[model samples]
Structure formats: C-alpha cells, structure tokens
Target: EAGVVQSPRYKIIEKKQPVAFWCNPISGHNTLYWYRQNLGQGPELLIRYENEEAVDDSQLPKDRFSAERLKGVDSTLKIQPAELGDSAVYLCASSQLGAGGYNEQFFGPGTRLTVL
Candidate 1:
C-alpha cells in the first residue's frame, strides 16, 4: 500500500516570508502528527491530531506556525514570517490505533525548507 505523501520536496525562501507544506496520509489512518527535524537531530513533534480535532499542539509555535487536518485525511502546515531558524525538514506521520494500544507511525519523505 502507498504511504504518506508530501509536496515540494524542497523549498528555499528568504527569511520572514510565509511558507506552507502539504501532506496526504495513508488511507484510513485517523491519527496524524507534524514534526520538525533539524540537522543532526531527531524529529520533534509540532502538532498531533486525532480525527479532525487537534489533540496536541503544545510544541507548535502558535505565534508563527499553524496546522489543520479538517477532514482527518490530508493536512497542511503553515509558517508565517518564517525565520532562518525555521529551516528544517517538516515531516508528516500517520498511524492507526490498533489492538493492545499499538500505534506505529509511518512518516512521509518530508518537505525540506531553507530560509535564507
């Protein structure tokens, strides 16, 4: 089966510009997460959603970052006034809650952003 898909594998933009990334998760996966992976570091969770509701977004920078999974399928993450520090790989992952509480996430190729 096909896994998650993300658009614009790479993007380069000037600092302070607005940017957006899109993701389409595997079919029937109800849980989704957005993560940011910096150079030489593991991905950090930015937001999480169960169905169409955002269940966790405490790590997301509300001041400049926002995300939505309106239909619990495709999701979009946006950053306004992007800063140089925002340069990183934005990843989208999805998983299904299975028996015995097993949930293994499958990640997309990710959108690499470079803020110059």
Candidate 2:
C-alpha cells in the first residue's frame, strides 16, 4: 500500500531563499513527473522522467529550478532564490505504465510552499 511520498507538506521561505522538495514514487513504477499548481489553476507539467531519463522538461524553468531522478525511483526538485510567484503546490506522481500510462499518474497530496 505504497503511494507517492513527499516531504515537508508545507514550507515557508523568503522571496529569494532556496527551497527543495523530495518525492518517492510507488515501487516498480518507472515513470515520474513533477507538476506545479497555481492557485485556482490546473497543474502544469514541469518535468517528466522515464527510467532515469528526463523525457520532457520544456516547461521547467531552468534558471531557478532543477530536478533529477537518479534511479528513476525517488526524485527531488529544487528552487534557487524562490520567488513569491513560486508559492504553489509541487506535486509528484508515478505509475507502472511508463510509456502508455498517461492517466496512471498517482499524485501525492503535494508540498504547499509559501514564499514571502
């Protein structure tokens, strides 16, 4: 009975402070994704990985954000100099069907970060 795990369900940081989030996906699942949800908006895909390979990350902000999935299992996302606009939900999800599991992503409750 394992689900997507995320630490620090809530975080508080200054506008220019650095913050990071961690995630552990369900065992045996090969695909992982990180999404950002703005208030009153749908989750936006920030990055997607397949077996340690980042398949898509075009929407990720390379300047201030970074992500990695070393073993394609657990992953982490970091934000350097977090901005007030970065205050949102950072969701992590994964599924057994990596190639065809478009709708199989099991999302976590998300880490709600507040930047001042």
Candidate 3:
C-alpha cells in the first residue's frame, strides 16, 4: 500500500544536458501518469498509461522527450538536450479503478529540475 515513488527529488543541470526521472506507482493501480508543472502553474499531463499501454501522450515532446512503462508496472521519463524552458517539477501519479470508475490520482513528491 505504498504511494508513488520518485528519485532524485531535485536536479540541476545545464542546458543541452540530458535528464531523466523515474517513478514507481502504487501497487494494484491500473493507471499511471506523468505531469509537468511550471512555477505558479498547475500540473499539465505529459503522458498517461493504462497498464503498459500509453493511452495519452500528446503533450509530451517527441523530439527530446520519451517515456516508457515497463511491464505495466514502473515508468521512466527522459528529456534529452534539456532546455531552460524545461525547468519544472516533474510529478508522477497513480490511481486505482474503483466503483463508478472513480480514479483519483495520488501524486508523488515531484522531481524539481532546474536548467541553467
């Protein structure tokens, strides 16, 4: 009954460097999501996975960003050649499918990345 977990709670890197974030969702959860939040802004969905299948990822930048959910359990998100604009808090969330299809996401402490 653990909550979502993320590593390297903070990261600082120069522009053009590659950075990656990891996430471990709660057990028995059928849905996982990755979001990015800029300062003073609400989180924006970057990607969503139903089990191992990526159901939504239109917001993720394909050129320098990639994500994967291995075996429908854990997930990773990467941003290559990072830019200053990419500085934000990356959040991972998970939710269980319950009665009436209620799926309330529980978020993890985000990885705050600062690009210089």
Give the TM-score of each candidate: 0.95, 0.95, 0.94
Model 2 residue 7 CA deviation in Å: 0.7
Span of 10 residues, lowest total lDDT, candidate 3: 95-104
TM-score of 1: 0.95
Q: Give the per-residue lDDT digits (tens) of candidate 1, residues 1-116.
A: 99999998999999999999999999999888899999999999999888888888999999999998887799999999899999999999999943213798999999999999
Query: Per-residue lDDT of 28-108 in model 3, one digit per residue for the tens?
Result: 887989999999999999998898888889999999999999999899999998999999999999987532137789999
Preferred candidate (lDDT higher): 1 or 2:
1
Model 1 steric clash pairs: none
Error of 2 at 87 (Å): 0.5
Candidate 2 shows a clash count of 0
Tell me the spans in candidate 1 whose CA falls farther than 4 Å from its real position.
98-101
Q: Which residue pairs show backbone clashes in model 3?
A: none
